[model samples]
Target chain A: MNEKNTISVATMKRLPLYLSYLQSLSPDAPVNISATSIAAALKLNEVQVRKDLALVSSGGRPKIGYKTVELIADLESCIGSEVLHEAVLVGTGNLGKALLNYNDFGRYGVHIAIAFDQNPENIGNCVNGKEILPCEQMPQVCAQRGIRLGIISVPQGAAQAVCDEMVKSGITAIWNFAHVKLIVPPGVVVLDEHIGTSLPWLVGHLS
Target chain B: MNEKNTISVATMKRLPLYLSYLQSLSPDAPVNISATSIAAALKLNEVQVRKDLALVSSGGRPKIGYKTVELIADLESCIGSEVLHEAVLVGTGNLGKALLNYNDFGRYGVHIAIAFDQNPENIGNCVNGKEILPCEQMPQVCAQRGIRLGIISVPQGAAQAVCDEMVKSGITAIWNFAHVKLIVPPGVVVLDEHIGTSLPWLVGHLS
Candidate 1:
């Protein structure tokens, strides 16, 4: 907590990876682990891992290193993993449904509070225990729930409009899966998950 | 393709974004575009955009900038967007089905030729016109088709096992959606899409 605001985005992203790896360790595994061990396991640089861990946890001793349980608790607290951050998803297509059914988001403290779509047929359906509402209800529902995160899974053409609505509803963070580059106002954070780009990057590497 | 081998991973990743943006432009829009214009649109550095574009295309003029149509073709060829790269996806779960149903991959020249799952109920099912086959047939199908790219959407526990099978079946590149850091040989490439990390990063930034 000492350097919470000072943690770089790169380190912040790696915190989840470290937490997931530590959580994946067996119950019978060693209680104490060195940064070198973690870095080796995750195929990361040892010095970088040490620096990243130091920002979150102060339990690293000279030789004994960090206690697994304490490090996990510190990471969880620092990354806000213990807090339930609610988000509203717009677009109830296959990708939206997959995001709804994705249980891992809960582990990272993200819960898709509701989903919305303009299609009348999709509006009355239930996906992964959450009912789909009409697109008209998005702003009201998000504002009522005090949700700060808005997920845009709609097509490229509708993404900007959906994002504008979310911003108007006071959502500060947007996770955009649409292919287009979203234009957001200042102070609004948008994480564009261009899933299409990953494939080409991989293919281009192979060729 | 003059500096194809010298292109950095960062530039390779950005090529698709640039291509997508260029393709999104209206037909009546300007036929020429400068890196400064692109930088403004995507909120990137002008120098970085120019350097990235220069690596892919030689059509950029000093003042008039690059012609839209020719630049698009050069970007496409550089990113290998014209070649149909066939891939096999493992796991027929919600995420797998979503990827199978995702049509944008075709725009990026990636085709999910087939899918596999261990669940007997899903084995014979068809998702987005691609049939889900039994897990046992994975190696034979991948080998016979000379599949170099493999997608891992299976659960974390089963990921490494499936990755090993894919490597044994002649797959050299893996687009892993599972939350595990896979261990591959020297020549193989693995792109781990850690979708879970994005949410926490967004929440952390907002907090």
Candidate 2:
């Protein structure tokens, strides 16, 4: 939360991936990880990895590379991913259920305390131990819990409405999975995981 | 596919998102969309959007902006997303099932012809009209079908083996959704869709 040098969102988005890769590496002895190894693991250019890491104060040694413990701590604090963030999911669709069932979010400090759905059939149900409540209760629950992150996995048509409700209920950030561009008031950050867009690029490289 | 000035993979990855936004726009008259508008919609910087768009030969007007149709055509051709690419998915897990059920891959020139799973229970099942086969048959099926793009949604432990199988089966590009890093031979592209990593970035912006 410290007001440090502003890091670009692109760089910030990649730091978690780097952290994940570093976490996967077996920590033994000095744990000097080169950017080339990190780049190879994450499918990133080594030069770009070094440049991104340079944004922070820590610099890698010539032969030894970066210290694992220090680099992880720096990145975790830098991205604020170490702090537990309570969040609520707005949809219980297939994608929503997948996200709710995905237990790895805790590693990144994200906890979906509850999920809401407009579908009456899904109300009062539990997914991955998280209760599925009525959509109407979302705003109240979010406001009461002081939840900052609102994840929207509803259909594109319903994404904006859910986003607006989250914003109105004091949610400051949103991780939208829907394919629509949501219009939100200022000071709210919307992180769109456009899972569909990557397919084109993957297909692009084949040719 | 044309041998134009090499575009960065990052830029190539974003072109589909731009095309998606363009596709959503109601093309009325000239449809001159400004970079600022695109940036606001996609949560990108206006300067970055302009710089990215500048990679292509087409330049936008000072105020009139770009022609929507022309931009879409250029991006589609640039990424080769206009042509269909056959792919085989490994792992019939929840994430794999979600991807199989997702019908939007056609828009990005990706078609999941079939899926393979190590789980005996899931081998005979079909998801979203795609048949799920035994993992043992993957290499043969991939080679027979001439599949170039391989999608891996297996768990972290099984991911590398699956990647090796895919590579042996002649798959050049892989779209891995696993939580671990995969090692592949030269000239093989691996696009990792780290679903968990986004949570950290989303939470990061809150602080």
Candidate 3:
């Protein structure tokens, strides 16, 4: 089986942004959107947009723009949302709780299967009907649920220890929210959510 | 004084990650850390790290490595947190509320000056001691409080309108969380908190 269709992550990242901008346009009717238009919406270069679309195997005509609906659906299939992704979010703090309450994940075919914490006071309770289990049971619960995605929202102090345990329990990808950087072995994927980086742009543009 | 230093937004984004890893070592530190070590922490290429650091007018020495404390201090200074930044968060929904309660902003000198919402019920409220004002009073409140930075967490439908109002009210930079890519003019900077572009590393590492 040829994997030339296997899109790069950078291109995959652009898919959602494209879909989002396309969503603003006609959903039922296919509208041809130029690479320059998409690029302008995304603050990206026009050539970069064309290159990304080409890599995704999208249909684009000369002089005319790409069909919005077809491009969106093609990009969606390219990224593989065919399988429902069950994820477990650890650390039920402000950030974690906010994520649980966020309604958009279902549209992406990803759902928070469970939430856990170290505090016994939180154990046996439920937030958004997802059981809040003890941190000790993470391995058991993760295995039982067949969870592959892990979202870490623990404080900096406990983040590394939790990540090590998560990796051991078979989590392949982690959306890390802790301020600390987790050191994981090769083949494990860690998504570091650094909120501070979003600060400078805000400062530079505003000041 | 002639300014001799300039850094790209991409490099600035990774500084926090490097600094935090250095902080993990604390007073007892490694004599030198290779680009590979930095790459491991960020799930990026060592070549990328070397290229980025090289642009900052400093290179890691062969024998002693980059001085940990000095490197961290330089990264901080490069980010320019000499004075605390004052930002007002508009539309205190789940995201804005989450940010208001976030405790980690102090290290970066980012302080939430105030929070505003369109709903009348949210007005006259206080989040983290910062008053929640009506959207109409933004211009006056922001000017009086010297707020140039703005965070937009409104619904997708209201994002552009809110941003226009913010810019009119004298906001300089906007950290957008509307799940939509904004088209801001050249003078203004718009950084999306969208996970599509935000979690690029996970897709590559996991694939």
Candidate 4:
């Protein structure tokens, strides 16, 4: 990883797609795969794919292209796929429970260690094996676990308060599913997963 | 909307964020708001915000900025927020159920009219008032309802098959939560919500 060459967010988002594509290939598939083929299969631009792959791996050969196994390894390492990052989830609602039940997070190197909710009934309840704790215990639990990643699945009204608690507990990165924009201090990275936005975009583009 | 000046996907994604911010403001908030203020509130680049706003609105005035109410309307119209898009959801798993239970989609002009599942136990089951239909009935139900949008929340192995059924049912736009990239016709749009990608990106960026 070269410090000088910063990967753009667009590229970062596509890294997993590329990884998924590579991983999906059969073991008996070609040892070397060209960027053009990869791009074609993924419906991405060839030049863009080449540039994105270059950031993580040494440039592919002129004819032979990238070695499949080596490229996958480079992608996994670059995307931090091998490291199991423990994250705490706030709000054990439908979306939160869905995420907690989602088994694919382990493939991306994330584990929802615990869930916290303000609702009394939700506390002590288990969703996908992880216990949901009271909201009051969030800060202490997160601090004790040294959890830096916080997932906000709380409702719009409660998202900010949950975010504040997460930040106070040393969370630096936030994956916010709530519609509201969070006010975080400098150095805090917030990825707002506004699922609502995509629908409108899709509908607007419909011919 | 001007077809000549096409809005970028990046701009489309940010429109909802801006709308959410504007909506969050109190009724007593100033009638006029500037791109700089919007940028500051959202922690986005001022120039980018101005450029995005320009695409949907008649460019803002030099001193008064934009009329808040009119700007909101322009955004709503541009994003097709006024029209309720009927959509069919495939897979009655946790993610699918979460989406069906999601009330916020109505704000984004989307209504999941029906849900489909292959499991016999899940079929005919109701979630958030909408009943889950058999997967075999998906094509017929979607086609009869004239559904243009389809949400694919099925597991990886089943995603492509569901996508195929969606396309067959006249679904031109797909909100795919599945990890696999669906191969659709040139005009068909697929917006993939790869939730797993964000965590690794967040973890990788952590200091």
DockQ values, each candidate: 0.58, 0.47, 0.46, 0.57
Fnat of candidate 2 is 0.53
> Among these predicted structures, which one has the highest DockQ?
1
Give the residue spans of candidate 4 off by over 4 A: A2-5, B1-5
Note the residue pairs that clash in candidate 3.
A205-B172, A205-B173, A206-B172, A206-B173
lDDT of 2 by residue, A124-176 (tens): 99988999998888778987888989999987778888999989888998998
RMSD of candidates 1 onward, in order: 2.1, 3.5, 3.2, 2.0
iRMS of each prediction in angstroms? 2.3, 3.3, 3.6, 2.7
Q: For candidate 3, write residues B1-207 as lDDT tens digits.
A: 112124556666776777667666756657666666778666677887877655543747865557666666666665556678888888887678889999667666688888989899888898778789889899998889878778898988899898998888887778888877776766777767765343433533443
Ranking of candidates on TM-score, top first: 4, 1, 3, 2
Q: Write the per-residue lDDT of candidate 4 for residues B1-207, one digit (tens) a residue.
A: 543126666788788778878878899999999999999998899999999898888848987889999889888777666568888999888999999999878866789999998899998899999999887887788778788899999888888988988888888999999877789987898888877666666766664
Using TM-score as the measure, the top candidate is 4
lDDT of 1 at A45: 89
Model 3, retained fraction of real contacts? 0.42
lDDT of 4 by residue, A33-125 (tens): 999999999999999999988888994898889999999988878776556878999999899999999877776677899999889999989
lDDT of 3: 0.73
The per-residue C-alpha lDDT of model 4 at residue A89 equals 93
Q: What TM-score fits each model?
A: 0.93, 0.85, 0.88, 0.95
Give the winner by lDDT: 1
The residue ranges of model 1 lying beyond 4 angstroms of the native Cα positions read A2-6, A26-30, B2-6, B26-28
| Chain A TM-score, structure 2 | 0.84
All candidates in order of DockQ, best leading: 1, 4, 2, 3
